[model samples]
Target: MRIFSTILDTVTQRLMSEPVRHDPAALSRIRRAMIDLMPKDANWEDERLRHRLLVAVDPTSLWFLRVELHQRLGRSVGEEVALESVQALWPLFEDSIEPALLGKRPGRRSNNQRGDTPPGR
Candidate 1:
């Protein structure tokens, strides 16, 4: 069991250190999805789950996500939601977040790698 644990830890560390290439289309879509998602989901009203998501995300990402949320729900909802909603909704969103994030990328390993941005307007 100890040897297996060690192996798992090593693999986890290696995966963490790998670099991902910049993907403009992916980042754009993610940003758009983040915006579009804010008001669509009913569970986002929970406070505890909201904060946990915020805590786990990068600050820049958090800021953008929050802005998206705030724009739709308004300042009162955004300011107060994290105080409690994050805990309640934590499991729902967190469980699938890693896959959702990686799946959004445009890398060959991404689920929909062939996805392309629309032609220039």
Candidate 2:
């Protein structure tokens, strides 16, 4: 029974350790979704991001691009909309990134958290 359990664990680890293979079409869809969030009158930064997305060959590249996307969207559309749209992309990256990392939203802090206090208060 112990040998059987060990073999099962080894098999499970092997399967889990294998790298996730992303489909080209799926990458394209994610890219398109991000690009759709861009403003109609895209600035140089937006153009650069668009180019990066076009040339990106893996899920990690697209994953990091979410930061730039959130910033651009926040500035152009407002934080609420930006947060929603960026969060929406998390599901699409499920197979690519660790689930634990996806749950934490950047810049999210409670009012009592450090640095949240305004100056001159």
RMSD (CA, Å), candidate 1 to true, equals 12.2
lDDT of 1: 0.43
Looking at model 1, report the run of 10 residues with the lowest lDDT sum.
112-121
lDDT of each: 0.43, 0.75
Q: What is the C-alpha RMSD of each candidate to the true structure, in Å?
A: 12.2, 9.6
Tens-digit per-residue lDDT, 47-96, candidate 2: 99889988888777888888888888899889978877887776677666
- Which candidate number would show the highest TM-score if scored against the true structure? 2
Taking all chains together, the TM-score of candidate 1 against the true structure is: 0.24
